[model samples]
Structure formats: C-alpha cells, structure tokens
Target: MGYKNLKVSIIGIGRVGLPLALFLENLGCKVVGIDKDSEILRDVRKKKMSFDEPGCAALLKKTKMTISPSIQSGVRGSDYIIITVGTPLYNHIESDLSYIKSVCTDLCGSLKGGQTIILRSTVAPGTTSYLKNFVEDNTSLKIGKNFGLAFCPERLAENQAIEELGLLPQIIGTEDNFSKNMTNKLFNLFGVELLFTNYLSAELIKLFNNVHRFTDFAVANQFSVIAEKYNQNIYEIINMANKNYPRGHIPSPGLTAGTCLRKDFGLLNESSSAPDLFLSAWKINEHMPFHLVNSAKKYTKIRGKTIAVLGYGFKKNSDDIRDSLVPKLLRYIEREVPKKVLLCEPNIPKKNIEGFKNTDLNSCLKKADIIFIAINHDAFNKETILGKIKKNAWCVDLWNVLGQKQLVLRYN
Candidate 1:
C-alpha cells in the first residue's frame, strides 16, 4: 500500500508512540494515536505536547490526526497496527509481558483478516516468536496466512526523536517474507536507511546496541573511581588518552541515567544462559549512582548544610527523569545529612519533590553551601556558577560541568 493509503493506529501514546505517529502522519499516512489516559488524549487533541522533542507539535497539528483515549475505538478499522507499549521488569528483574499480551489479546478480538501487527516495543530475542504463537492460539487465526506479524525496534534518543527517526537506519524483521516486505514498505515511507533480517536477530540487535553503550560507559565510570583514588582529574586523563592515533575514542564519564540503558541491560542479563562481560557492565553502571553519592560526600561536609542541586533531568535539554541518578544522590544525602536540601531544577516543578526550595539559577549559586551539578543543562553551564559559589562551599561536578578549580570535586 502507498503511504497515503495506509491507515495506521499506534497504541500507547507516550514518548515513542506519539512521535512515531507524528512522523508517519507527516509522511502522508492517516494515523490515529491511542492512549488509556484521558489527559494525554486531550493534550494531543488540543495540540499540547508533553516532551520537548523537535518538530513534534507542528506535525501533530498539520496532519490533523485523531487521538482517542480508547484503544478499541482507535484500532477498529485501521489497516496497520503498531504496539509501542512499555515492557517493564517485575520484582525479580524478569521481563513483564503483561502489557504486550494485553495489546495482542485486544487486537485478536478485533482481528482483521488481512491486517498487519507490528511490535515496536523492546523484548528478548524469543519474544516475537512467543507473541506470534500467543496470537495464533488465542485468535484461532493462521499465522502468516490470515495476518502478518513483524518486529521493528525503535532506536531514537529522548530529545532527538523526530530528527533521529528520519535520520537513523531502521532495523526490521518478520517470520515471513510478506510480513517483512510489508513492514519495510511502511518504514521506507520516512525516507531513511533500512536493514532487513530475521525476527530474532532484529530483537538481539537492539539489545546488543544498548549493551555496547553500557560497556563503554561502565569503563569510563570505573576510570573515574581510579582517578578519585589517586587524587587525579578524570576529564583531563580521558582527554589525554583520546589523543592516541588509533585508539583515541575515549568516552566521557558521567551518571548513566535513562529508561532504555538501565532496563535493557537488566533484561539482557536476565535472559542470558551463559556468563558474559555484559553482566559486569550492568553491575558497574548500576553502582555508579551510589559511587557518585559517596564521592560527593567525601569532598563536602553536608552535615547541617544546605545542598543545592543544579539539574534534575537525566540529560541535557530534556525533561525526562526516568532512572535519573540525582534522586538517588539526593535521597542518600538526606538520610546522612541533618540539613535542609534545596533543589534547583528550572524545568521541573518544585511541588513534585518534598522539602525542596525552589530558587532561580542566580540565588541557588549564591546561597548554597554545597552545590551538586547532576545534569549539564545549557543554561546552568553558561552562567558559570563555579566562581559565584561561597568561598567555603564545596562543589560536586558529576558530569564535569565545572572546570579545574580548587573548591570543586570533579567526578569526571
């Protein structure tokens, strides 16, 4: 089917689904976004976007797509259905397939004979096959004969969803050639590169990508610990190490916080049958949060002192705080210290965090006895709060936000 004739329905209008719907709609497809939350549906209908992604709101408004709070109403007459629901882990770190199963069961009840079902959620290597079996058994429909199934993993950054969606090469796979070609044709509408493989390989490719990133960041975090032991600067050491001709690709050290990075590593480790180095990478990255808290405490006397936090988001220029390391650090300090804590997040509301005093960038720098630079926001970096802090105040730079100074404890 052509892009203009494709009627697509996206389930779960969160970070991934909402942007994907907008991108598909921009490519001339008739798209409908489905979410259980009425507030999210209302915001989309009123042209209000929750995240700070580029080119999202304009596309949503320009396409004039339908956003419905009911999933059944959204997917009733759609030719193509894409499931982007979350796959969180349970208490034992096992992959929770409850959401994915629910979507599949619902779609089976409303199964169209020639419709295509695509899974955009991340899962284990054998998850796609399991889903296919579940659908075939529950719906009494023949797989690869009556309906098509495929798995197409999403690999976009948080703040750069729209730009990366059009730029990054898409990886897709299916159980049959018809499903493969159908999914590829749908994705090629965006005018980007495409890589077609088997379903299991596509699932493993997503996991491998995140595991590689976790390994690199774990190495950098370990180096930061070594630097603290020798009273040396990690940023300078990393810069010098990257000067080599062939092996000069040293990554910077910082708090590795995000939903995909942390959860994907845990999934890979849980699903692994043999021992591997990825497990070590997972442990190191998981401990980096507490390591940062301990390192900050060693440099500052936080007892009975006001602690000022510079940023609360996971990364720069984004408002997503999932798996953010700052909360762990704040909670640790609050348990150990006997003083008031002042959080200074410009993007997040002050009411979300209890006992947090809301202050502007200037006042936080002037009054804080110990300042922690958790995230490297653009506004916080340009103001140069290092020189403005009190003479006796201690500064903790987790992402190397401050330059080489006498009062700052540079973690990376």
Candidate 2:
C-alpha cells in the first residue's frame, strides 16, 4: 500500500516523536502522537514545544494529528507504530530499557496483525532483536508472519530534526521482506531513501555514529588541554591547520554534553568487542567539566567567588538541556560553596532558571567575578558581551568565542 494511505502512531513525543508525527501529518497521513507524560502531551496538544527545534511549533499548528497520553488507545488501528521513547543510561553507562519495556507492555495489548512496529530509539546492538522477542513472548501474534517489526534508528540533530528527517538517508533494518516493504513505504513518503540492513547492523550504525563523534570531540578537547598547558591558543592552531585541508577536519573543543554523544559512548563501550579506544575517548570527554573547573581555579579562587555560567544548553542555538554539562560545572562549583552562582541565558526566560537567581546580562556582568561560557550561544557572544562585562571580571571562553583581551581568557 502507498504511504499516503497509511495511518501512523508515534509513541513518546519528546523530541523525535513530536517532529515525526508532524512530518507524517504534513504528508497527508493520519497521525496519532502518544506519550506517557500527560504534561508533555498537554504542551504538544496546545502546539507548545518545551525545547527549541526549528519548524516544530510552526508545523504543529497546521497538522491534523491526534495527541494522546495513552499508547494503547492512540496506536489502535494504525498501520504503523513508531517508538521514539527515551533510552537513558543507568549508572551513567548501561541502557535503561524500563521506558521501552513499559512502552512495549502498553503496545502489545493493542497490536494487531499486519501492522508494523518501528523501533526508532537508539539502543544497544541487540535491542531490536530483544523487542522482537518481547512482543512475541507477551502476545499471541507471531512477529513476521502475523505482524511486522523494523528498526529505523533516529539520526537527526536536535535543532535540525525537521529538515534532517526529510534529507538524511534513512536506515531501515528488518528480518523479513514484509517488514522492510512496510517500513520503506513509511519513510518513502518523506522523500528520503532507505538503506536496508539487518537489525544489529542498523543499531551499530547509530551506536558508532554517535560514539565516534564523541571520540572526535575527545581528540580536539585533549589537544585543547595540551595547548592550555603551554598557555597557547588551540583555536588558532586548529583554524590554520584546517584552513583548506579536506582529508579529516576536527571539531572544536567544548563541553561535549548532549543526549547522544556521552550516552552512546557508554553504550558503545558496553556493546563493542574491542572497547579500548572507546573507553579512552570516553575518559577524555568525561573529564572535560573537571578540567574546565581546574582551569577556572587558576585565574580566580573558587571559594567565595561569584561565577556566572552563560548558557545552560549543551549545543549552540538550541535550548535542549538534556545531558548538559553546565550542571556538572555547577556541581563542582557548589562543592566549593561559592558566594553566588549567576545564570544568564537570554534564550531562557528570567523566571525559568530553576530556583537559581535568573539575572539579566548587565546584572550577571556586574555581580560576577568569573564568567564561564558553557555554551557558545549567540546571545552571549563577544559581540554582545565585550562591552557589557566588567573589566575586573575574568571570562572563560571554552569555545574560544571571545576576542583578545587581558581579562578574557580563551580556554583551550
């Protein structure tokens, strides 16, 4: 059957699920968006997105999608059920499948024959196979013969989900041709080509995709630390080296905190046969926050110091706080028991700093003795911050985002 004639139900409308539902709805497919969190569902029901994702809120207003809190009810009679739930880490390492298992429990009761279930969450390599086993064990229906199952792990960047969903090459892995054809038609409507593979291979693709990105960031961050030891600028060296060289361009060093990079690095170490390189990279990236804290100690005394963290979000131009490293810095600062901690994120409202004093730019500049640029938000760039900051205050630029100045310490 053609995809336009399909009805799709998306579970867990946090980041990926919300946009996926809207995109499918935009393609003239009847869509149902389900989540266990009623609060999130209420927000999405009113076209309110909690995070900053491009084109989500705008398209949400125009889409004809059913937003529900019950997975069993929402997924009924749908041709496809797409799972986009969280697979957060346990003990900061292993996959916590409680969320996915609960979702399976809710979905297995309402699942019908000839319907396809898509696993879009990033999981350990054997998770899709686990899902296949879980469904068959719980329900009377067989997986491939009576029903269909496929794994199409999400690969979109946080802010660019809408565009990347339509542009990036999709990987759909299944055990049989029935599941493959059904999954292919689902993505074909989005104008994205599907690269077919087995279940474990598709899972590894996402696992390695993110883990390697973490390793790449780790390499640059290690170099940045080395440069700082010599009291030199790593950004200048990185820029001159990559001016026109196209063989292998390295990413800039910053707090490598996001939902995927660190979480998937842990997953990769657990899943990979040879995990020496992955473990080493993980150690470098994991120690970055402490490294910044130690560097901050050099310029100013942490005890009884007023430190201002510029942005709370991990990525630039995006307000997603999932696995953000600002809190890690804050945790370290809290250990020192500083006089005051000021948070200034213009993107986030003054009232929403979460019990901390939400001060304006001018206030943060005036009160803070040391300022740390945790995220290179355009709101707090050198263009906007240079004249505002007090000359006596020390600024730590983790991303080399500041101009040359005595007080402005461009942290490697």
Q: Identify the candidate with maximal lDDT.
A: 2
- For candidate 2, the TM-score is 0.94
Can you write out model 2's per-residue Cα lDDT over 1-412, one digit (the tens) per residue?
5548799999988888898888888888999999888889788877787777889889988777888889889999899999999988898567898988999999888999999999999998788988899999999988778889999999999889989989999998899988987888888888888899999999999988998788899999898889888887788878777889987497888888888888887766675566498788878887887888888887778789888888887778777778888888888877888899999777765566666766787788877888888887878776777777777777888787774522236232
Off by over 4 Å in 2: 271-275, 405-412
TM-score between model 1 and native: 0.94
Per-prediction CA RMSD (Å): 2.4, 2.3
lDDT of 1 at 308: 83
Which candidate's TM-score is highest?
A: 2
**Model 1 poorest 10 in a row by lDDT:** 403-412
lDDT of 1 by residue, 178-200 (tens): 68767877887888999988888
Work out the TM-score per prediction.
0.94, 0.94
